[model samples]
Target chain A: MRVRVFADADWPQVWQIVHEVVRAQETFPYDPAMTDGQARDAWIEAPPGLTVVAVDRDRVVGTAKMGPNRSGPGAHVSTASFMVAAADRGRGVGTALLDFAVGWAKAEGYAAMQFNAVVETNRSAVELYRRHGFEVVGTVPRSFAHPTLGRVGLHVMYREF
Target chain B: MRVRVFADADWPQVWQIVHEVVRAQETFPYDPAMTDGQARDAWIEAPPGLTVVAVDRDRVVGTAKMGPNRSGPGAHVSTASFMVAAADRGRGVGTALLDFAVGWAKAEGYAAMQFNAVVETNRSAVELYRRHGFEVVGTVPRSFAHPTLGRVGLHVMYREF
Candidate 1:
């Protein structure tokens, strides 16, 4: 899979990936009733951020975004969010997206990285990040109410990459 | 120190902490120019949540808020925001606040806990949570724009306890 910063032309494909992945109401914390415009704003907002797409055989299969976690005095560290098409999980799409994020962060002079809310229910994503050096620094208990799982814990992970 | 739910009686002290700690322009992602009323509304907004203050000898030294990180279907796991007065730093007030939050969560039947947007520059806060068994799971690049730190990484940490 080849990953690259998304171009204007890539928005449609990338948006499709985000829509499908988020529509599940499982991985993302967004409102289940989120519209296309709002989702777009949520994913593609502000400055100094990377909205990238993963391509396989000229088809977009995954998407991710990387940007400064915050501004001013604590700007050195960066953060990222990743998503793989439901049909493409366990096939290395997440790993590739993470690799892109980490490489970009390190070269960009970020001192660390942080994830704010990872659904505790998503064990695969948690394991992937843990294997990649991230850790559960804190937990927001019952922050997300899962449809099937009921109340699920959201994991807050971080690493000094 | 006696820790209990915050009431109208604690507003003065709450404002003092917010003015002193949150006013630093580095510890939070919010703009330093926010007014007192706005901060209060953001922190203490009504039922189904609790705001607590730790009082030492009748003076407030620390404060925290516990509530749903997300509303509706995602409101099971509770999220908390804490602030300890700089003058009160080694007093274990933060631990008390955390303990209160965790116990409250456990009693409330949450499966896990997640801390969203933990500032990377806040080493003491991070270490405190780490000692409490929270792990950093994912990092968001440029999640918040800090006043002095330029860009800050937001850490998403979680613990299942």
Candidate 2:
């Protein structure tokens, strides 16, 4: 699989992945009823920020959006969110996307990268992040409502460049 | 002092307090050179979100803006930011504003209140929030750059209703 900057043509595939993930309501905190325009606005980063897609033989398999965590003093630190096609899980698509994001942030001169809310129940993603030098700096208890697990803690993951 | 919904007439006084607090670079992470329009956009909340001012006699001494910390599922948890006039420090203005914000969030049917970033070096504000039932759920180390203290942690303080 190869990762490249997201283009307008990738929206349909990206939206499909985002829709499934959001509707599952098991990981991300996005509104499940979000419309195409809303999702596009949320996923497509502009200018200093960026969004990328992972493709396998001409098919978009995963996507990631990244940018500064906050403006001003906090801008030195960056943040990112990722979503892999449900059917493409366990194929290292998420890993490839994360690797690209970390490299992009480092090239952009960020001092660190922080993920504000990683649902605790999403163990696979957490473990993946941990393996890639990220650590769970803190977890806000009972912040995320997992469909099956009820309310769960949201882990704030961090990694310094 | 009484707290009331912020009005257009209060902008001048409110801007003074916001300018001083933001310029200090000791508490909030706002841009030091933020324009009046940028500051106003950041300080004023509309509709579901609310911004209020603490009035002493006939002057605005403090201000706070609050609303959902994030959209959708995360919307259940509200958040707020407060600023008290520099000359009005230690006069319980901050406490009064906190009290009003907490009460307003509860009345708005929020499940809890979460402060995304509280500069750890800001002991007075930290202690005040603790006294008001906010606990540092997690602290992201070296996330904030204090003007004098150098790098500081940003605390994610939360209080469940």
Candidate 3:
């Protein structure tokens, strides 16, 4: 699979992945009922921030966005979020997207990469980041309400590059 | 000292405290030169969020804002930020504001409170939070650029009530 800059035509596929993730209420912090426009504004970032997709045989299977975690002085540290098609799990789409995001941030002069709210219940994601050199910097207890598991912690993961 | 709901008339004083903190660039993540309007827009909370002031004999000595850190699924977890006049530090102004914020979040039925980017070098603020039951859940290495200290970690502090 190859990661590439996203295009306008990629929105339909991107939305599919985002929709699946949000509706599950299992990982992301997004509003499950977020409208198309709202999702676009939230997920498809503008310049200085990047949004990209992973393609396998011309099919978009995963997407990621990266940019400064905060404005002003904190802007030197980059933060990112990702999503993969439900059926695309374990296919390395997420890995490809993560590799691209880290590389992009490093080339852009970011001192670090942070994941602000990785739900602890999202074991696969937590493991994936660990394999990629990310560490669990902290966990906010009972900060996330899992649809079926009640409240859970959210892990703040980080990697210095 | 009394903690009270913020009002339009509080803007000038609020700006004073915010200006001192931002200009110091030793604590908050805001731009040192952030304009009055920009700071106002960034610090003031709208609906679904709350902003308040700590009044000392009719003077606004401190301010705090609390709200959901994310939308939808993660909205149950609350987050807050605080600022006290540089001259007002160590006078129990920050303590009062923290107490008020914690109580406000509890009253609003939030599941927890999280501070996303607390500069590690800001020892006083970190200690203040610890005194009020917050724990250092995680720290992102080199996530903040201290004006004179080069780079420093940003702490993610959390508390559940």
Winning candidate number (DockQ) = 3
Give DockQ per model, in order: 0.19, 0.71, 0.76
Q: State the displacement of the C-alpha of residue A51, model 2, in Å, after optimal TM-score superposition.
A: 1.1
Candidate 2 colliding pairs = none
For model 1, how does the per-residue alpha-carbon lDDT over B16-108 read when each residue is reduced to its tens digit?
A: 887776668656665466689977987784767788999999998999988666644565556788999989998799999999998988888
Query: Can you give the TM-score per candidate against the true fold?
Result: 0.61, 0.96, 0.94
Q: In DockQ, how does model 1 score against the reference complex?
A: 0.19
A85-113, model 2: which lDDT tens digit per residue?
Answer: 99999999999999999999999999999
CAPRI-style quality class for the chain A–B interface of candidate 1: incorrect
Identify the superior model by lDDT, candidate 2 or candidate 3. 2
Residue A12 accuracy (lDDT) in model 2: 98
Predictions ranked by DockQ, top down?
3, 2, 1
Every model: iRMSD:
4.9, 1.3, 1.2
Model 1: residues >4 Å from true position, as ranges?
B1-26, B29-68, B71-73, B76-161
lDDT tens per residue, model 1, A123-158? 999999999999886666566667788666667687
DockQ of 2: 0.71
Write the number of the candidate with greater TM-score, choosing between 2 and 3.
Answer: 2
Candidate 2 chain A: worst-modelled 10 consecutive residues by lDDT? A142-151
